[model samples]
Target chain A: MVGVIFKHTLRHSWLQALYWGLGLGLMALLVVLVLPLMDYNKMAELIQNLPPFVRAAVGVGDDLEYAFSTEGMIAVGFFGKLALIFAVYPAVMGMRVIANEEDAGILDVVLTLPVRRWQVVLERFLAYLATLFIIAALVFLGLWAGAQLTGQALDLSKLAVSALNLLPTLTLVLVFTVFAGALFGRRTVALTAVTLFVVGSFALETVGGMAKGSAAEGLRSLSFFAYFDALGVMRSGLAAANVAVLVGAAAALLAAGLWAFQRRDVGV
Target chain B: MVQSDPIIQTENLTKVYTSRRSQTRALDRLNLSVQPGEIFGYLGPNGAGKTTTIRLLLDLIRPTAGRARIFGLDAQAHAVEIHRRVGFLPGELSLWRSLTGLQVIRHIANVRGMRDLRCAHQLAERLQLDLSKRVRDYSSGNRRKLGLVIAMMHEPELLILDEPTNGLDPLMQQEFNQMMREVRAEGRTVFLSSHVLGEVQAICDRVGILREGELRAVERVERLTHVDFRWVEMRFREDVPAAWRERLGDISGVSEVSIDGTTLRVRLQGDFDPLLRAVSGGYIRDLRVKEPTLEEIFLTFYDGDGKRAAQPERVKELA
Candidate 1:
C-alpha cells in the first residue's frame, strides 16, 4: 500500500520534497562542511566580543568560552540548531502533499473508487515518511563526509543513532498535519495545525520555565519536538526515550487521522 | 414478484443548501425509481435538482431529508459498497491536468481493486479517443470519452451517467447509444440524466420528467411515443373565416389552433384522429398532415414566464 502511494506521488514531481531535502541539506553542508574549516581562534575572539544574552542563549558545548579546535567550533556554532529546522521541513511539506490533493479536487476522483478514505490518507502519509527518510539520509551522508574530511574524533556510532533518532520524530509532524487535514478538509487547516503546534509548544515551554515544580519539565513532555535533546544525542550517542516519544506520538496522530478520515464525509 | 425491485430507488429524498444569507432547497421530497437492465432517462431543466440528486446518490452531498438506496443498500451508510458496483460520470468533467487518459483509467481501476487493463484499451478504441495524450490537451469530445471509458471499463453492474453525451458528435452519439444498448442487453442498469429529449428518447426504456424538484411524469418510452403530439395543417380556398375558429375551438383534442394566411396549422393535444376530423369537417379545402417532434412537446411544459403545470404543491413552493 505504501509502495503504491509512493509510486503515485512520483507520477507528479511533488517539488516540496526536493526543496525540503535541499533546504536542510544546504544548512547541513554550510555547518558540517564549512564551519569545521573556519579559523577557530578568530571565532573565539568573536564569542568574547558577543553580547551576554546571545552568549548564554543555547550553549551546545561546555567549551563555548574558547573556540579551540575545528570540531569544537563546528559543534558549538551549528550542530544543535540544524536538527530543529530539519524536523520542520517534513511537517510543512507533508501538509502540502496531503492538503493540495483536496484543493486540486483530486479527492473527488479518488473518493469514487472502492477503497476506503483512510486508505488514501494513510498511503499519502506513508509517502511523506519516505520523503523524510530521503532528506534524513542526505543530511546523514553530509555529516559523515564532513567528519571524514576533518579527521576529527567524531562518533560515527552516535551520528548513526542520531539519524535513526529523527525518523519517527520527523514523521510525527507529518502525521499531526494529516490528523488536522482530516478534520477540516482544507489546506489551510493543515497550515493552521502546523502553526498552532509550533506556537503552543513554545508557549508551554515558556510557562513551564517561569515557575514551580517539574511542571515546566512535565509540560515539555507534551511537545514531541521538545523530546529531541540534541546535546544528549550528540554527547551520549543515543536518546532511546526521545525516539520512543517520537514514534508513539506519530502512531497516535496517524491513527487519529485514519479514524477521522473513515468517519468524515468527503468533498464537504 | 420481488424481482421487480429497482436497482436504484429514492423515496421522498431531499437536500437543502443553506448559506449565510439564503437557503436553497435543492431537492425537495422527490420520489423516483430506476430498474435494472434498461437505460432510465432523468430529465430536468437547469437548476431543477437533477445534479443534486446524483450527488446524494453518490454520497458526494448529504440529503437533508428522506432516503436513497442503490442496489437495495443505504446510499450513505453503504457508500463504498455501492460505489464498488457502480460507475459514475459527473456532469462536469474535471480531471487532473497532468494525467493521461490511460493514467486516469489505471488509477480508478487500481482503487477499485480491478486488474483489467486491456478492456480499457478496447473501450478507448470504440469511443474514438486517443488515450496517449494528457487530459488537459484533450478536446471536449475526447474528455467525455475518457469519462465514458472509465465508467464502463470496470464492467460494473450499474452505470450512473450525468449528461453523458454532452460533447459527442452525431456519429459518436449513435455509437454511444449502441454501447448503452449493449450494456442493457447484458442485464446491467444505466441511469442517464439529460435535458435533451431526442437523445433520451432514442435510448431510454423509461423516462422521468422533473420540473421544479418534483417529478411530473414517469412513463415508458412507448407511452411517450404514443402521446407525442402531431400537427395538422389545412389550406383553405380562402382565408379561415371567423366562423371556422369558433367551430374548431369546441374540440377537446386540439391543444392550439393557429392561422397563417391560407394555411391552418393546429397543435394536437393527444390523439390526432379526433383532432383531424374536427378540423377537416366543415373546411372543404386542401389539408396537410405532419408529426410534431419531441422539441415541441418539451416547450409545452417549459413556458416563457417560468410557468409550469399547476400541480404538486411541493413543486409550487420550490418554484
Candidate 2:
C-alpha cells in the first residue's frame, strides 16, 4: 500500500517537480554566469562590514574574518538557497494537494480504499518527503555543476550541511498545508491559508531586514525563511541550534496535520 | 427460506448534520439491514439521505447518534477492516483523472491487499472500458464503469453502491444487474442505493424507501407489491352530470377524482373494479389506464398524507 501510494503521488506530481527543477537550476546557473565580474577580495571586505545581527537573521551562523574566503561565501550561499527552496517548493505544490483533492471530489473515492484514514494522510506525506529529498539532490547537483563551470569548487561539507537545513523546513511547509487542508471545510480555504503563511513569512522577512532595530531582529526569528543563512554554513558547515529548531518544528506540524485529518468531518 | 446473519445491520442508525443556522437531518434514526447473499435496494428521492447513509456505513463521516456495525464490528473503530471487506461505488463518481483507468484499478487492488489484476481486466472488457485512456477523457458512462471496475475488481465480500447505474444504458444496466446477481450467487451481499425503481424491483429481495430524511417503509418485494396503485382516465360521450361525480366519489378504492369536459382522471387504490364499474356503462366512450410506478409510492410518502400510511416507528425516528 505504501509503495502504491508513493507511485501515484509522484507520477501525478512529476510535472510540477520538473518545472521547479528547471527554474531553480537556471537560478543556480546565474552564479556561474556572473562569477567573472565578481571582485572576490572587495566582496569579502563588504560582507565583513555588514551588521552581525542582519547576517544572523539571514542565517550567517559562523564568525567571518575574511568574507571573500571560500568558506564564508559558501556558508551564505548554501544556507540562503536552502531557505528559499524550503519556502518555494512546498508553497507551490503543497498549496493545492489536500484541498484540491477534496474540491475535485476525488478524496471521497480515495477514502473508500481499504487503507486506514491516517494511513492515507501519512502515505501522501511520505511521498512528499521522498520528493523533497529528490528535489534537494537536484538543487545540490545544479549548484555543484555551476560552481565547477565557474572554477569554484564549493566546500563539500558546507554543501552537505546546506542540504540538511532544507530537509526540516520543507517538511514543515508540507505539513502546514496538509493541516490547513483538513481544518477547512473547503479546498480554496486550505490553499488560501497555505499561501498566506508562505507569502506572509517572506514579506515579514523583507520588512525586518530592510528596517533594522531590536524589534525587527526579533520578528525575523518568527519567519522560518530567515533561519537558513547559507554563508554561515559555508564558513561553519551547519549550526547545531538551527537544526534542532527546524526538526522540532517539522515534527510538530506533521503531528498536528495527522490529528486534524483523523477527526475532522470529511466526505463532503 | 434459508436465513443467515446480515453482513450489515443497523438499529436506529441516525446521522444529524448541524450547521449554524440550520440542523438539516441528513439521515434520520433509521433501522435497516442487509442479509448475507441478499441484493438489497435502498431507494429514495433527491436529498433523501441515501448518500449520507452510505457515508456513515464506510465511517467516512460519523453519526450524531446510534450505531452501525459491519461484519459485527463497530464501523467507526473498525473502519479499516470494513473497508478491506467491502467494495464501494460512490453515487458521485469522481477519481484520480490524471492517471490511466488501469492505474486506478491497480492502485485500488493494491490498497485492498489483493494481488489479482485479472478480475480488473475481465471487468473492463465486460464494461467496454478503454483502460489505456486517462480517466478525464472517458465519457460519463465510461467513468461510471471505471468506478464499478475499481470497486468490484477485488471481489470483496460486500458491495455498497450508491446509484451504481447512473450513466449506464439499458443494456449496460442489464449487464450490471447480472453481475450483481452473480455476486449474490456466491453468497456475497450487494447493498445498493438507487433512484431507479425498475432496477430495484427487478433484482432486489427487499427495499427501503426513504423520504424527507426518513425511511418510510422497509418490506420484502412481495409485500410491497400489494401496495401498488394505478390511475385510470375515461372519456364520456355525454357530459357527466354532477350526480355521477358524487356517485363516483362514493366508490371504494378511488382517490383524486377530476373531470375536465370530455375526460375524467381518477386515481385507484388497488383492483380496477370500481373504475371499470363506473366507466363500463354507456356514459363512457374511451378509457386509458396509467400504471402506478415506484415514484408515486415514494412521492405519496412525502406528500404529507402518507405519514400515517408510512411506518410510524420510522417516522418518529426522523423527528
Candidate 3:
C-alpha cells in the first residue's frame, strides 16, 4: 500500500521534480563555470572591507581567507546562497502532502481506499525524499561536469560532500512543514509557520555566526541552519554529529506528523 | 423467511462538530440497519445528517458517542479491511484535476492492488464517460459520471453512495438506476443517500427519512407511497352553489373543502367511495383525483413541529 501511494505520488510530481532539479543544477553549473573567470582576491578584499553586520547579512562569517579559496567560492557563492531557495521546494511539497489535498477535498477520496492513514503520510514523505535525492544528485553532476569542463583541480569528493550536506537540513525543513500541516490542517497556517521557521532560522544562524562570544552566538544552536555548515563540508568532509542531529530531528518531526494525521478528521 | 445479518449497521451513532464559537450536532444517535441484496435509500433534505451518517460509516469522521459496523467489523478499527470490499461515492466528488479520467482509474486500481482495468473501462463505457479528458476539462455532469464509474468498477460486496445522481441527466440517472438494480440482483447491497424523492420511489426497496440530524422513519417504499391521503379537484358544469360546498364538507374523511367559481378542491384521507358518490350527485364536467406524490408524503414527515416524527412507530403509523 505504501508502494502504491509512493508510486502514484511520484507519477504526479515527476515533472515538478525535473523542473526544480534541472533549474538548480543548471544554476550550479553556471556558477562553477563563471567563478574561474572572476578575481577572487579582489572580491574577497572588497567584502572584507564591509562592516561586520553587512558581511554577516551576506552569510560571510569573518572567514575572508577561506572565502578566497576555490572550495569556499563554490560553497558560499553557489550552495550557501541557493540553499534557502531550495528549501522552499520541500516546504511547499511538504504542505502539498496533506494540507493542500485536504483543502481540495481529495483526501476524502484517498482515505476511502484500502490504505492506512499512516501509509499515506509515510509514503508521501518518502516520495518527497526521493525527489530531494534526485535534485541533490543532479546538482552534484552539474558541479562535477563544470569542474571537468573548466579544467579546475577541484576535489570531486568535497564537491559531492557539499551536495550531500544539503539533504539533512532540507529534510528537517520539509518535515517541519509536514508537521505543521498535520497539526493545523490548513494551508495558510502551515505555510505561514514554515515560512517563519525557515526565514527566522536562516537569519538567526547568519547573525549569530558574526557575533561570536556574544549571547546571539548561542542562539545559533537553536536554528537548523547551524548544522548545515556548507563551508566546513567543502573544506573538510561530512560531519557525523551534524548529520545525526539533522536526520534525527527530521525523523522526530515525521513521526509527530504521522501521529497527528492519523488522529484528525480528514477534509473536515 | 429468516432475516440475514445486516450488511451495514449503526448503534446510536452520533457526531457533533465543535468550533470556538459554537457546536453543531450533525448526527444524533442514529441507529440504522441495511440488509444485503437490497437498495436502501437514505432520503433527506439538505443538512439532514445524510452525509454525516455516510461519512461516519466510511470512517471519514469519528462518531461523538457511538459506533458503526460494516460486514460485522468495527468501522474505524477495521476500516482498511472494510474499504477493500466497499465502494464509495462522496456527496461532493473531488478528483486530481491534472490527470485524465483514465489516469485516475489507473491510480485507484493500482492502490487496490488490482492489475486489470477492464471493469473500469466497461463502467466508463456504460456511463458514456470520456476517460481521455482531464478532470479540469470535464463538466459537472461528466464529473458525476466519472465518480459513478469509479464507485461501481470494483464490484465490491457493498456500496455507499452519497448524492450519487446529483448532476446526472435523466438518461444517465436511468442508467445508474439500472446499474444499482443489477448490483442488488447479484446479491450485493447498496446504501445510497439522496434528497431526490422520485429516484428513491422509483428504485429503492426500503427508504429511511432523516431530518435535523435525526432518523425520522424507515419504511418500505410501497408502504410509504400507499398512504390513503389524496388531492381531489373537481370542475362543476356551472358555478358551485353555496349549498353544494356545505354538502361536500359534510362527507366523511374530507378536509380543506373549498369552492372557487366552477372548480371545487378537497383533500381526502380515506374511503374514496363517499367522495365518488357525492361527486356523482353534482353535474361534474371533470374530476381529477391524485395520489399524493412521494414528495408530498415526505413533506408530511417534515411538516409541523420538527420533533413530531421522532418515534419510528409513529412514523410507520403515519405512513
Highest DockQ model number: 3
lDDT of 1 by residue, B1-319 (tens): 1247778888889888877899888788888877778788888788778888888898877788999999999988898899889988878777778888888788777766778788889999998899889999999899999989988898889998999999999999999999999999999999988888777889998877776776666657655555445787888777776666656777776757787777777766666666667655445487677754554554554454434543222222111
Q: Write the per-residue lDDT of candidate 3 for residues B35-127, one digit (tens) a residue.
A: 889899998889999988988898888899989999999999999999999999988898999999999988888898888889999999999
Report lDDT (CA) for all predictions.
0.71, 0.74, 0.86
lDDT of 2 by residue, A173-264 (tens): 88778778867747678868877877777666666765666587578788766655455555566677877776688778778777877887
Off by over 4 Å in 1: A1-23, A39-93, A96-98, A150-152, A195-224, B1-3, B17-24, B63-65, B210-217, B221-319
Candidate 2: residue A222 Cα off by (Å): 2.1
**Least accurate 10 contiguous residues by lDDT in model 3 chain A:** A56-65
Against the hidden true structure, what lDDT does model 2 obtain?
Answer: 0.74
Poorest 10 consecutive residues of model 1 chain B by lDDT? B310-319
Per-residue lDDT value at B31 in model 1: 80
Predicted complex 3: DockQ: 0.67
lDDT of 3 at A123: 90
**Interface CA RMSD of each prediction in angstroms:** 2.5, 1.2, 0.8
Chain A TM-score of each model, in the order shown? Answer: 0.79, 0.82, 0.95
Q: In model 2, how large is the Cα lDDT of residue B35? A: 78
How would you order the candidates by lDDT, starting with the best? 3, 2, 1
Supply the DockQ value of model 1: 0.29
Clashes of each: 1, 12, 0
